[model samples]
Each structure stands twice: as structure tokens, then as C-alpha cells.
Target: MVELKSPAEVEAMARAGAVVAEALTAVAGLAEPGRTTADLDRVAADVLAAHGATSPFLNYHPRWASSPFPAVLCVSVNDAVVHGIPTDEVLADGDLVSVDFGAVLDGWCGDAARSFIVGTPRPADADLIAATDRALFAGITAVKPGNTLGDIGFAIAASVRRDGYGLLADHGGHGIGRTMHEAPHVPNEGRRGKGMKLRPGLVIAIEPMLIGDGTEDYVHDPDGWTLRTASGARAAHSEHTVAVTDDGARLLTL
Candidate 1:
């Protein structure tokens, strides 16, 4: 069932979202050539600690996962689509890094992700990132009372496809609150006005993952977590936690 958060619960979630933003900011600041992905993970871990927040990602074992997740942050790079585990692999000057993290504060959960280049970015990579971010905004824009879930999906898919980018299928955002994942799974592409109607108190994560070469095909990394482009194309992802309110959409992770 889709569980809605009370106004006070939503406010508490914003506090968790703040911690998530801080961790993402610190991770972005520390991401550079010569630093390992693990290094960025440490910075995020520290940020969560400083805020007295816990990671919902740590030790999380989903039905599809081979084992419990061992890291607080998922740092995907270049062709990796999502859930890239942090390792000692050194980042290169032109690597496109995407970090996905979540924080739980006082039992509320906030999740977000962003893709960026380590140093100077290739024109194509920058475009991919921009398209992904724009798609995320489009998705967030659809989060309002009376809008359907399909509207959110259509908005995001249209935004990315207009820029000649493709998105991974089946992997999208979800309802979030006391738990990181909740009901009312939100897709990145859908027929407008075909799904659940958006209502006040509905809180969710809006994320868009765009494929650089304009194809939905992707290959799963043997790690059972990381997913990569099947055509060896690069990808970018962007996300934010948002709440559907009486007035409009309220971004908790801003």
C-alpha cells in the first residue's frame, strides 16, 4: 500500500534530506583525479556521522541483491549505470562519477543522486549529465496533487529523449519515508494519466538515468549491484526527494 506522510513527518524527512545533501556535497568536493571511489565514500560516511544520520543503504539486502550492501554510498563511474560499489579504483581525469546516497534521521529517509565529471568533461559527457538533470527536474515538476504517476514518467522520459538520450528500463524512483523504499513505485517512462493520482502527503524520490548512446540496453556487473551499458555507452543519473503538497511540489532534498 502507498503510505502518505503527515506534515510533521515530511518536515522530519527534510532534516534527513539535509544530511543527504551535505554528504553529496562533500563527496562531490572530494571527487577528483587520483582519488579512489572509496575515498569519496569515506567523505560521505563522515558527513552522515557528523549529522547523526544513518545510511539506509548500509547492509541492505534486497531480493535481487546477492548479499547485503557493504557501503554507505554507491559511486558509479563512466559506463556504469547505477549501484556501483565503492572500491580502491583510482579515478581518472575524465571519469563521469555518479553518487547515490540516502540518510535516515529520526526514522525518516531521504535519497538522492547526481552525476559529475572528475575534471574537465567531454562535451558529450556534459550533455548527458545536463539531460539527466533536466529529466529529474521534469519528474519533480510532475509531483503535485491531482497529477498522475504517469505524468511524472512521461515528463521525465520526454525531457531526456528530446536531448537524444535514452534511459535504463525498469529501474526508477520510489516512494520514500520511514523506509528508504516504499509503495507506489515511480517509473521513468509511462503513459500520461494512466497511473495513480498524486495526492497531498505523497513523498517520493524522482530520479532519471540517461544512457549516452540512446539505447535502453544495459549489462549487469558480476558484483550483482553495478549495472553497465550493454553497448559500452556512458550514462548519467540525477535525482531528488520531493513531496506532493496542497500548494504544489516541495523538494525535500534541495
Candidate 2:
């Protein structure tokens, strides 16, 4: 069932979102060439711990998975779309790194992700990251009382498609609160005035994943967690946790 949060409940989720934002900020700064995904994972774990929060991804075993998640973050390198696992693989120059993370604080959850260039980036790669980032914010802007989920999705799709990138098909954002993933599957592309109407106390994660130059199709890696582009093109993802309020959309995962 789709659940709308109370104002006080929204405040709790905001606190969790703050921890998620800080964790992402710290990990992003440390994500340079030569750092392994595991290294960044540790950074996020420590940051969440300091805030008295724990990783929602750790030991999380959603249906369709055989084992619990063993890492604090999803680290997808170039050509990888989402759900990338942390490994011994070291980041190299000019690589595109996508970090997806979540935190549980006082029983609420916050989830967000971003992709960035490691070193001196290629013009195309840099452009993709920029577009994806803008798309995420554009989607968030559409989250407000009375708006439909389609408004958010259409905004993101229009922003990225204008630049010629393809949206990932299989995965999208979701409602997040006491649980990691909840009702309201927020897609990256949809028609405005469609889907569920937004109301005060509704919190959702708005993310957009764009492929550099390929179809929307994606395939999971052999590890059972990592998702990569089917055509081997680079991908970028960006997200933020937002709450619909009587005033407007407030970003919790800033």
C-alpha cells in the first residue's frame, strides 16, 4: 500500500537523509583514481556510524537475490548502470564512478546516488554526468502537492533526452521511509498528469540513469547485484530524496 508520511515522520526521514547526503559527499571527495570501491564503502560506513545510523543496504536481501548485500554502497564504474557491488577493482583515470547509498536513522531510510568523473574526463563523459545531474534536480522540482509521479518522470526524461541520452528501462526510483524501498514506483519516463497524485507527507526518491549511447536495456552482472549497460556504453545516475509538502517539494537528501 502507498503510505503518506506525517509531518513529524517526514522530519525523521529528513534526519536520515542528512546522513545519507553527508556520506555521499565524503565518499565522493575520496573517490579518485587508485581508490577501490571497497575503500569508498568503508568511508560511507564510518560516516553513517558517526551519525548514529546504519547502512540500509548492509545485509539487505530483497527478493530476487540469493544472498544479503555485503557492502554499504553500490559502486558502479563506467558502463555500469546500478546495483554495482564494491570489489577489489581499483578506479583508474577518466573513469565514471556511480555511488548509490542509503542510511537508516531512527527507523527511517534515505536513499540517493550520483555519478562523477574520476580524473581528467573525456568531453562526452563529462557531458553525460552534467546532464544526468541536471535531470535529477529537474525531476525533484516537479515533486509537489497535487503533482503526479509522471510529472517528475517526464521532467527527468525531457531533460536527459534533450541531450541524446537514453534512460535505463528496468530500474527507477521508489518511495522510501521506515523501509528502504516502498510503494510508488517512480519511473524515469512517463506522461504528465498520469500516475498517483502527490500529497503532503509523501516522500520519494527521484533518480535518473542515462546511458551514454545505447538502448534502454540493461543486464545484470554475474555477481547478481551489478547492473551494466547491454551495449557497453557508459552510464550516469543522479538522485535525491524529496518530500511533498503543502508549501512545495523539500529536498531531504541535499
Candidate 3:
């Protein structure tokens, strides 16, 4: 069943969202060329600690995974899409890095992701990132009372398709609250005016994963987590946790 959060619960989630935003901001600054992905993960852990928040991603074992997740951050570099485990691999000058993170505070959860260029950006990398960012906002704009979940997905997919980008169809957003994932899976593409109707107090994480070469096929890394483009094309991801309110969509992770 889809659970609706109370106003007080929403406030608690906002606090968690603030921690998520702060950690992402701090880690983004440290994503330099010579730093290992593990280094960025450490920064994320420290930021969460400073805010008295706990990482929701740490040691998280989903039904599809073989082992517990090892890091607080999903550092996907270049062609990787999402769930890229942090490792000792050093970042290069022109690599596109996508960082996905989540946090829990006062029993509520917040999740978000961002993609950025390390040093010198390669051709079309900035465009790819911008497209995903735009798609995320498009999804957010579609969240309102009486609007269906399909409306949110259609808006996101329309924005991505306009830029000629390919979305990771199998993976999409999800309802979030006390748990990291919940009911009412939010896909990135769907028919408008269909699916579950949006209502006040409903909260979800809307994320867009776009590929530069317009391909949806991806391969999982041997580590049983990381997902990379099957054609070796670069990808970008952007996400934000939002709440459907009486007025409109309130972005908790802003």
C-alpha cells in the first residue's frame, strides 16, 4: 500500500534531505582528477557524521544484490550509470562522475544524485548532464494533487527524448519515507494521465538517467552492483526527493 506522510513526518524528511544536500555539495567540491572514488566516499561519510545523520546506502542489501553495499556513495565514472561502488580507481581529467547518495535523520529518509565533469569536460558531457537535470525538474513539475504517476514519468521522458537521450528503462525512481524504497515505483517513461493518482503527502524520488549515444542497454559490473553502458557511451544522472503538497510539489532535497 502507498503510505502518505503526515506534515510532521514531512518535516523530518526535510531535515534528512538537508543532510543529503550538504553531503553532496561537500563531495562535489572534492571530486577532483587524482582523487580516488573511495576518497569521495570518505568525504560523504564525514559530512553525514557531522550532521548526525546515518547513510541509508551503507551495507544495504537489496533482493537483487549478492552482498551488502560497501560505501555511502555510488560513484559512477564515465560510462557507468548507477550503483557504481566506490573503489581505489583514480579519476581522470575528462571523466564524467555521477554520485548517488541517501541519508536518514530522525527516522525519515532522503535520496538524491548528481552527475558532474571532473576537470576538463569532454564534448557533449555537459549537455548530457544538463539534459538529466532538466528532466528531473520536469518530473518535479508534474507532481500535484490529482496528477497520476504516469504524468510525472511522461514529463521526464518527454524532456529526455527532446534532447535525443536514452533513458535506463529498467531502473527508475521510487516512493521514499522511513525506508529507502517503497510502494508505487516511478518509472522515467510512461503514458500521461495514467497510473496511480498523485495526492497530498505523497513523497517520491524522481531520478533521470540519460545516455549520450541514445541507448538503454547496460551491463552490470562483476562486483554485482555497478551498471555501465553496453555501448561504452557516457551517461548522466540527476535526482531529487519531492513531496506532493496542497499547493504543489515541494522539493525536499533542494
Candidate 4:
């Protein structure tokens, strides 16, 4: 069921979102060649600890997973799309990295992700990251009272298509509140005006994942968590938690 958050609950969620944003910023700053993905996870854990927030990703076991998540950060590199576990793998120059994180503070949750290039960036990789970032904002802009969930997905899909990128249809956004993942699944591609109607107090995470090779097929890693593009094409992801309000969309994870 879709639960509309009260004003007080929304305020709590905003606090959690702030922690998530700060941790992601700090982690992103450390993304460089020669740094290990596990190193990034350590930084994220410190940030959350300093803020008195708990990691929502750590030890999280969804039905599909064989075991609980082992790290605070989802560190996807190169062809990896999402759910990438932190490993000792060293980041290399021109590698495209995507980090997804979630934090819980005062019983509320916030989730977000960002993709960028480490060290010397290739032109195509930079463009791929830029496109996903733009798509995230486009979807966030579509969040407002009376707008359908399809509207959000349509806006995001249009942005990706305009850049000639492929959308990861299997993985998309979701409603977020007391829990990390909630009701009303938000796909990256859909027909406008075809899904649930948006309303005030409805908070959601709008994320867009795009592939460089224009393919949606992906494969799972031996870890039973990491997802990578089957065609070995690089991918990028961007996300932000937003709330639909009477005025407009309020970005909780800004």
C-alpha cells in the first residue's frame, strides 16, 4: 500500500536524506584512480556514523538475494549497473563508477545514487554520466500533485532516448519513507498518464540508469548481487529522493 507521509514524518525523512547526501558527496570526492571500492565503503560508513545515522543498505536482504548485503555502498564500475558489492578491486583511470547509498535517521530513510568517471575521463563516459544526471532531474521535475507515476517515467525515458542511450528497464526507482524501498514502483520508461496518480506527501526516489551501447540486457555476477551489462558496455546511474507537495516537488536528498 502507498502510504502518504505526514508533515512530521516528511521532516524526519528530510533529515535522513541530508545524511545520505553528505555521505555521497564525501564518497564521490574520494573516487579516483588506485582507490579500492572497499575504501569508498569505509568512507561512507564513517560519514553515517558521524551523523548518528544507520546504513539502510548494510545487511539488507531482499527476496532475490541469497545473503544480506555486506557493505554500506553499492559500488558499480564500468559495465556494472547496480547492486555492485564493494570489493578490493582498484579503480583505474577512465573507469565509470556508480555509487548507490541509503541512510536511516530517526526512523526515516533516504536513498540516492550518482555515477562519475575516475581520474582521466573519456568523452563518451562523461557524456553517459551527464545524460543519466539530466534524466534524474527530468524525472524529479515531473513529480507533483496530480501527475501520474507514468509521467515521471516518461520524462526520464525521453531524456535518455534523446541522448541515444539505453534504459535499464528491470531496475528503476521506488517510493521511500520509513523503509528504504516502498510502494508504487517507478519505472524508467512508461507511457505518460498511465500509472498511479501522484499526490501530496508521496515521497519517491527517482533514479535513471543508462547504458552506452543501447542495450537493456544484463547479467549477474558470481557474487549474487552485482548486475552488469551483458554486452560489456559501460553504464551510469543517477538518483534523488523527492516528495510531491501542494507547491511542487521537494528534493529531500538535495
- In order of listing, the candidates' clash counts read 0, 0, 0, 0
> How do the residues 1-254 of candidate 4 rate in per-residue lDDT, one tens digit apiece?
99999888899999999999998999989989899999999999999999889998999999999999999999999999999999899999989999999999988999999998899999999999999999999998898888899999899999999999999758889999989999989988888998999999999999999999889889999999999999999999999999889997999998
Per-residue lDDT tens digits for candidate 2, residues 119-187, read 889999999999999889889888888889999888988998898899999678999898988988998
For candidate 3, lDDT tens digit of each residue in 1-254?
89999999999999999999998998899998899999999999998999888989999999999999999999999999999999999998999999999999988999999999999987799999999999999999999999999999999999999999999859899999999999889989989999999999999999999999999999999999999999999999999999999998999998
Cα deviation at 44, candidate 1, in Å, is 0.5
For all the candidates, what are their Cα RMSDs to the real structure? 0.7, 1.0, 0.7, 0.8
In model 1, the runs with Cα more than 4 Å from the true position are: none
TM-scores for candidates 1 onward, in order:
0.99, 0.97, 0.99, 0.98
1 or 2, greater by lDDT: 1
Give lDDT: candidate 2, residue 131: 90
Tens digits of lDDT, candidate 1, 1-254: 99988999999999999999989999999998999999999999999889889999999999989988899999999999899999999999999999999999998999999999999999999999988999999888887888899999999999988999889978899999989999889999988997999999999999999999999988888899999999899999898999999998999987
Please give the distance, in angstroms, between residue 8's alpha carbon in candidate 2 and its true position after superposition: 1.4
| Cα-based lDDT at residue 225, candidate 4 | 96
lDDT of 3: 0.94
| lDDT head-to-head 1 vs 3, winner | 3
Question: Cα deviation of 208 in candidate 2 (Å)?
Answer: 0.6
Candidate 1 Cα deviation (angstroms), residue 161:
1.3
Q: Is candidate 2 or candidate 4 better by lDDT?
A: 4
Model 1 score (lDDT): 0.93
